[model samples]
Target chain A: MLKLIIENISKTFKDKQAVTGFSAELSEGVYALLGPNGAGKTTLMRMLADILKPTSGRILLDGKDISIMGDHYRDSLGYLPQEFGLYRNFTAVRFLSYFARLKGLDKQEATTRVDEVLKLVNLQQDRKRKLKTYSGGMKRRLGIALALLNDPKILIVDEPTAGLDPQERVRFRNLLSEIAGDRIVLLSTHIVSDIEYIAKEVLLMRQGTLIQRSTSEQLLDSVKDKVWKCTVEQHALPQLQKHYKVGNIQRVETGIEVRIVSDQQPLADAVNVTPTLEDVYLYFFNEEVIDGVQAGML
Target chain B: MYRQECYKIFSKKSIYLVFITIVLLLVYVHQLPTDMTMRESVFEELEETWGGPVTEEKVERARESMNAADAGEVSNHTFELRATDYVQFLVTGAAMQKQDQSERLTMLEAEMHDFDEGTYEHREAAIEHDMLQALDDVHGFYLIRSWREMFELIEPTTHVLLLSILIFLGLSPVFADEYTNRTTDLILATKHGKTKLVSAKLLASLSYIVIVFLSLQIINSFLNLLKFGGIAGWDAPIQGISSGLDSLSRLSYDGSPYNFDVWQFFLLTIALQLFASIAVGVIVLLLSFLTKNTMITFFVSSIIIATPALLQQLGTTDGFLGYLTDFSFLKLMQVSTLFTQFQAYNLFDYPVLYPYLLFILFAVVTGLLIMLTYRLFRNQQISH
Candidate 1:
């Protein structure tokens, strides 16, 4: 089995430490890197993609240092950056063929692979259109297609579903799951739902440090009885929001039904409910951040 | 990869637009004047009447006809008189140049006696004297006004400026645009990105320069041909063509040391242009890698390419400043001045031709810039 070992990886830019002492061993499955804005997920993904050299670390693929491996490592690696631009004047077919050539594919193989990836991304019908004419969703799918052109062993995609619609996001998630059966896929995203059904393990990052690495069930188990549901007056929701980490709030005929993530129940009618990855996200990230701000305001 | 890079540069609509602009400018500048056409027609008649090897018989007949026109002995002799006057000037100038060379040779031989036989000064004087003696006598001319005018029009400085603009507009975005468009990360992640892709980009840039430079040349030549008539007297010596012109234009080729005729000199100017274009292309690419902004790269390249001309215009062509401007890439592009006089640099005890040293220095600088550009781009950190 192919393996990628990221050992003691850290990246510092000037005075700011973007990623600190990040280490993980990944093999033949999709690992989702979960982090909020400014959480260094992109930095870590960039390092893994080999586009950015880590300040002090070594990334190894199949027992060889990736930096030393160089092009040999890139030959087996694929990456989709959080943001990118395409040659606006090139048609989808031409764009893919260009990158296919850059990936070291010969003319015949490049033509064949371009057609296959276009079909895979469902861009075959629009293959004749210029990239400038592509919608954001279409462009995102094309980006995914570009990443898969080489059938890489290690695939790193950072926020791959950021601008994707809900249907497209689900389609992308399923696509990742289908492709991960034989490769190590490292996906960095903040959206819990995008990885909820597909990720083999979810890694939570906060302020450049990994706080948790567990499967969905295990992560949900970590926040189990901490989730409670209660009905409260609409006007009292603000106070509850200030004092607690709120998850989902729905307007009912009586007033409002709110889901709360907390260690202890604060009301008489509140009942324990099953936890979700979203509640976990709120529990780990939102609770501390909202509490600090609420405390400061008070 | 190389083909795609070429596509990226050539596909820009601005390139075509700039090309059209160049064509229109050439057309506007080279419109044929009626009076010049009539005068050249008369010169053609004179060439058929008395062409080749400025014989004494032809000179006497031209003088008699000119005097007849003055004495009212002949009608409609104005055009014939002017053409003959031009021939007379050519003969006089050639004799004067031969005399000047002889006097200078005598002076050099006398000056050499004051220095030791093996001294650098003695060697330098001997070299200068020998170079002056090597120049061949000015040959005869036949309907050379068009060729002469075309030679003057192909000024190196003007064309170099035009070349710099075209190169800047086409290549300033080679590496910088990738950064601007947020595509550097993707390209830098590919297997060939740091290696073959860089080479491809450089090759494509040079190809673009050649295309632009040739387009400029073709347009200028085609329009000038349409306006100025046939390129007659192509084999005439450079020293012969400038004769009979005004004093200002007369000094254009006053003492050129090279044995090249009109066609050879034109080819040398084109070679100089190609060299200048490559040097400018290399610098533009280096700036693109360094700045990562297209407009910044363009403006900075323009400033660098134009500084020598600007300083020269500001009267800095005297001492050290003069040497600096004279040996620059701009001066290299403006090639006529370099050949106008035999100038040499004293390296140690030996003298190297100034034109030869200019080419060697730029070739080295261009090679170094290419290496620097590759290193910076290949190892660039895509932090953003």
Candidate 2:
């Protein structure tokens, strides 16, 4: 059983604190770190990947400090950064083979694994083609394939599905679900739906701080009865958004269909609805995710 | 791993571009010595009176013949001065008509150990001192008859020097490539990324340097031999060649007899240049780690590498600046100057050979650069 314990981690870059006092103990399941852009999701994932050391606190694997553990700890760690890149001139196969060598796989093993990963990413036909010619979705899939090269116990990926198409996103989510198995997969994304089905636990973050951590169901239950779809006149939509956390706003034939998460109903005819993870995300971080960067300073 | 790193370094089209550029430059600039053709022209011009090679009898006869000629014809009494014994040529020939030959020779010999206060005179004296020291035990001097052999050996070095510069260009991107491609995150995160992988890159760069250096030397050597058809003065002291009006200089040999033949001196020069190339490779590799931009590293590296040559061209190679520059860098690559001049840094009243001192200094600098590269890269935090 692999265990990773992050104790009071924080990162300060110049005058900005990108990650602040994040602590977690994870083992054997997919944990979705949900946050919007610039919410320190990337920074936290980088810390877990051991690519960026926290300014304070210790990250340990199996009770030993990852910092002191170094490469030995890294051997069981796989990371796919948000802005992943491959050598432009390197063919897909060569790119994977080169990385395999760096990961300390032997010649025959690296070659075999390169072929396997190429097939796993569904890029076998394009394995011999230069990476510069690969499409966005293909590159993202290749990045995922690279992350799985060493079959690590801990997998950390940040904003992985941002460039992928909708179909590819669903496929990728399924792939992540299958690979998560008995390993800790910390999947970070701002898109709530990406992890709604697969994430065993959801960690909600705003302004570099963890606001909440619970199962998806528990998170949705917290916002139960809070989500109310109310039919209102088009003119009343703006006022409704101003007073409550608006999850979705749409215009209809007669008026507008508005979904808002709030404690009290704004309309008498509004019906209570079950919250999706999106509604939960909107409930906890509706105002904070958008205004968090400037809000704390104000 | 090293092979892969080398592929990253050498397989680029830019490397081949640089190689082709250097090859073209070598073809244009490299040529055998011209001293022989010059001597033959002089011999043809003076064949009526001096129809034979310059000997002691020919010298006496030419002096007598000049004395009997009319004053107007005295100006026409000139002949090519291609004598290997430069001092002896000065004394016997009419090149120095104002000063007595015997007194000038005595003054030059005296200046070997003693110096003058006047700036111009001191420099001239120093030059002469070094020249004489170069030819100290050199005997049986002769005029330049055929320079084909002499030039064949020296011409190829242009390619060597140019190839060294090309090496800097080829290696400027070792670290910057990862940054430009945005692969540093992946590469540095791997298990062996920071340690063995870095080691592999360094080894690949060094091995490429060696291969380029040795290949250039071999190509030049072979082409030179093929073109000139002989190594005539392979074992002859350089003091035996009269270079017309070309200034004579000599290489220092670390207290060994100043009696090295041309072959030994050429070999030493090649060795010194190779050592300098190693230092240059390390320097380029160091610059590669300082930033994640290849252009910046290449630009700064060009400045650093060319500083020595620029200082020489700017005439900063004389007193204080010269003392340091002479024992530092590209001076070792100047085979002609080292072969003809006995230049040295008089350190602590001991004339230590510049090449010996230079290679030692390069080794230390390269070592420090390597350490600095490791420290910088190992502790690096990617900001972009």
Number of the top-ranking candidate, with TM-score as the measure: 1
Clashes of each: 0, 11
lDDT, model 2, position A234: 77
Model 1, span A182-259: residue lDDT tens: 999989887888888899999899878788899999999998989999999988999998788898999999889999
The TM-score of predicted model 1 comes to 0.92
Minimum summed lDDT over a 10-residue window in model 2 chain B is located at: B246-255
Model 2 has an lDDT value of 0.70
Docking class of 1: medium
lDDT of 1 at B195: 81
Looking at model 1, residue A121 earns an lDDT score of 82
**Fraction of native Cα contacts reproduced by each candidate:** 0.75, 0.71
Q: Chain A vs. true chain A, TM-score per candidate?
A: 0.96, 0.95
Q: Highest DockQ: which candidate?
A: 1
lDDT of 2 at A94: 83
DockQ of 1: 0.75
Candidates 1 onward: DockQ, in order: 0.75, 0.61
Which residue runs of candidate 2 sit more than 4 Å off their true CA positions? A289-298, B30-137, B141-161, B238-259, B316-324, B332-351
